[model samples]
Target: MRDVLVIGGGIIGLLTARELRLSGAEVTLIEMGQTGRESSWAGGGIISPLYPWRAPEPITALSRWSQTVYPALTTQLLDETGIDPEFTINGMLVLDDEDLDQALDWGARHGQPIEILQEPAPHAIEPELGPRPARALLLPGIAQLRPPRLSKAVRRALEKRIDLREREEVCELLVADGRVCGVRTPKGQVEAKRVVICAGAWTAKLLEQLGTPPDIQPVRGQMLLFHAKPGQINHITLHAGRYAIPRRDGRVLFGSTLEHAGFVKRTTAEDKEALYNDAIELFPVLRRTPIEDHWSGLRPGSPSGIPYIGAYPGIEGLYFNAGHFRNGLVMGPASARLMVDLMLDREPILNPAPYALNASR
Candidate 1:
């Protein structure tokens, strides 16, 4: 029996399994499909929440901690696995002025430096921006990573250290004497001392029979990728819930629409056209550039966009670390660390009460 059985291979699960292994626990990670091919691979990889001030404090805390440690974590991953996640601090420019006051106040309270740029200033920061807003907020410390690359890097690092089971779906939890003993997969039952559910959008379904499961549902988001020249857009540009992320290699990721489509991961032409129009409105250069790819992923949406991360009620040795919504990539590391800490009985990095499964109850 392994010390831990992670029931998903997304970013959260990969990171959690890695953390558990680092803490000297034998870990086995099983995925329904190929690892990192779901939401983790499809996200824009923004290291911070879209609007830090607008999110709940728990999300802020997790993102803040994750942002701080990202550099070190990526560096270590590069050193060990020879893959660069391309963690870049290119900053983020908010073109919407509706939340300026709240944003400033939240920045002040959180000690995050935010600059209000006016006129040519916003244009000066991002020359590719078209029809700029009168005022904009600049989060200079914001960063982004290539999600596919990061996922690959983390998987590469974990492949050698932990038992990674790809293409194996965990259909049911095996319980004995009122305790979770293992899980049932298509192949066979694998026993474990503890089980952690990091199944992303599928988390709630897995826990439905257990009890009052976390309010997690699949929120579908479709994105379009544009191939542009390097340095065309210097920062992440956001307006009206849509954003453009410029990668290190001249590829810009323009996304996304939050649709309650219920586990449907198919991309649509209508959404692609809408997203293209929005992207061009933000960065006019994209009008001429070709869209390299279009895809969709289902985010694990929860109430208030807060993820549930703690032990399961009435089920010993069962735990949860899912429901991150759109911020899973940003909150992955800290969420994993916190889950591991609670599981191993170590001092957690932040208050675990807010993320507990019973917090809402």
Candidate 2:
């Protein structure tokens, strides 16, 4: 029997296979489509877990821990596979004073070098933003990664021996004699000793087949990207209104409207216009840039805005690591680590209390 069967090809599933394989376990990863094309690939790729006022503690902790591993991790992947995740620190800026205060407090408490700047700091693409006001908090270490690149590298690294089964859609968790023994897929039955469901927005649907979907639904997000003035905005600047995330390359990812509509992955004209209007306001020079593309992804959102990790209460050997919402790209590595540690050996880096599947109970 394979030591582990990861039933999704997103960041968490790929990372879990990596972690478990590091522990010398035979792992196989299954994906219904090309790897990392889901919400994991569709995110803005923000690295900082620090929200302005409120953020979940367990998830935030995991993000911080993952940030430490990213440097060595991405570099090693690049060296081995010649695929750069494009990990770069572009700094995150806060515009609102109220939000900035919350950021300062939390950052100081957590050893984050969130700087409070009085004067406008030197930034790339200053002309596009068109004379923004001063008062900004700069998180020097916060950054971004190319999600598609990381996903490709991880797939390449794991596909050799991890039994990567793409285009294999998992239909149900096969429970026999009160234990998760395998999974039912469209192609055939995958027999395994254990199963890990990492099915992002589709997690609830899969779990419902097992009779325990944990109140997770699709929170649709609309995003727009532009090949704007090269180096117009270098830092990740955020306000209560919108966010502008600039990559090491010339592209600027402006985005993401949080809507509670269920399972709608289609883009809308209004959301597109809204993003552009907000982007130009943040940096006015964007008026000249062509709208490169627009897209949407359905993030798995829970009521409390937290992901459920660890084992399912009723099913033995059944595990869930879904419902990450917006933090998937930022915080998936550490969460996957915690999951592997807990499920493989029943020991985790931090107390897994808050993120327990039954935490609300």
Candidate 3:
């Protein structure tokens, strides 16, 4: 039997397969579509969730671990494959103050470098900003990486290292005597000692057949991209439930309407206009720049905004690392590492109790 079979080819599956392979396990990864073309590619690529201090403790822990390791990991990927993921530490600027008190206390408790800014600091930090915000928080440790480049780099690096299959969809899990043995696809049944479901938004469809589906639903997010000269925006500027992420290549990404649209990845004109309005509110100069792209993807939303990332309940040799919602890019690294630790029976970097498949919702 093959050592491991990873279903789905988003950032989570790719990284998990890479981790297992590095531990000397023979791994095979199957993707329904092209690798990294799902939610991972459609994301804004900010390494931290906007207003992270208010997030769940599990989310914070995984994101912090990912933030700590992303630099050296990206450097190694770039060295191995001639692809630069453009990992940048430009920081994050939160312009909303609705939850400022709670966020500040959380940051202080966690020892995060969250600075409360008054007038002039916002404009001084990012001159392109139209006006000073009512209240601001400067998270200097926050960073970002180009998601497409990072996905491509990892896929490229694993070309010869693992058995990567594309256009192969897993139809069902092969179970025998209450234990997962392999998976069934349209092509054939591939035998593996273990199976992992990293199918993102479609994970529910697969898990339901096994009678252990988690409460994962699809949340659609639409984004607009604008091309401007570099340095137009120095940091990831966020305000009023929207954000503008500027890539190093002069591309400013403005996103994202959170709608429970059920696998519909359509970008609407209304959302586009709304996103444009939000973007120009922060940087009025962007009003003059033409929008370059508009697109949408489905994020796997779990209960309480935390992903299910451990052994599948009541099933042996079946695992899961899906339902990360909008934080997939931010939590991918640590989530993958934790899954490897669980499958190998080793202690994880952080406590795994909070992220178990059957953890309290």
Candidate 4:
């Protein structure tokens, strides 16, 4: 029997397993498919929320804590696994001004640096921007990483430390005497003293036996990638609800569309066209560049966009570290740490009340 069993092989599960092993617990991670091939691999990997100032207080807390630790975590992973996650502080530029006041107020309250630019100022920051909007908001502290690289790095780090089970689907939770003792896999039953559901979009389905699971559902998001010059686009650019991310290797990722399609991971031509047009509008140079790839991933959506990171009210040995909606990458590390802290009854990094299983419900 393992000390802990983590369901899901995305970033959240991978990190949680790592944390548990570090705390001297025997951990086993099971994924329905290959690890890191889900939303963790499909995300753009912006280390901060899309608009940091606009996120709720709980999200803001998790994101801020994660940002502080990402540099060190990525460094350690690179040193141990020799796989660089390419953590970079490229900053971000927001072109919309509808929430300027709210953004400014939030930034001031959080002590986040925000610069309000006008006309030529915006163009000076990003030369590729076709024409400067009337005004722009520059958040110089934002950072980003290559999602695929980060996922690979984390998985590599966890391989030798834990019983990492890939392509093994956890079909059901084994609850005996009102306590989750282990999980039922296709092969057989695996026993563990404790279990955590980091199943992302499939979290709710896995917990269906327990009536009224956390209000989590799958929200589909599509993205388009373009091969451009390394320096073609300097910083992450956002306009309306879409944004363009420039990777270190000159690959620009433009996305995405939030749709309510159930378990359908297929990309649509309509979304591809819309993303391409939006990318061009954001950076005119993309007009000449051809799209290299197009894909979609299902994000675990919650009512408050806050993930649950504690034990179920009446269920023993069962915990959740899922339902992060769109900010999974930004909040993964902190969420994983918080989940482990709560499970072990240790001092938590942040207040656990906001992320309790019953908080959102």
**Number of the top lDDT candidate:** 1
Residue pairs in clash, model 4: none
The candidates, ranked best first by lDDT, are 1, 4, 3, 2
Model 4: worst 10 consecutive residues (lDDT sum): 352-361
Pairs in clash, predicted candidate 1: none
lDDT (Cα) of model 4:
0.91
**TM-score of each model, in listed order:** 0.98, 0.95, 0.98, 0.98
Q: Where does model 1 exceed 4 Å of error?
A: none
- lDDT score, candidate 1, position 144: 95
- Candidate 1 residue lDDT tens string, 1-361: 9999999999999999989999999999999999999999989999999878989999999999999899999999999999999999999999988978899999999888999998989988788789966899999999999888888999999998898999999888998887999999889999999999999999999888776778999999999988898989899988989999999889999999989989878999999999999999888889999989999999999998899999998889999999999999899999999999999999999999999977862
lDDT of 1: 0.92
Please identify model 3 stretches exceeding 4 Å from their true place: none
- Residue-level error in angstroms, candidate 3, position 66: 1.0
- Residue-by-residue lDDT tens digits, candidate 4, 20-41: 9899999999999988999998
Q: Which runs of model 4 end up more than 4 angstroms from their true locations?
A: none
Cα miss at 20, model 4 (Å)?
0.8
CA lDDT of each prediction against the hidden true structure:
0.92, 0.80, 0.90, 0.91
| TM value for model 3 | 0.98
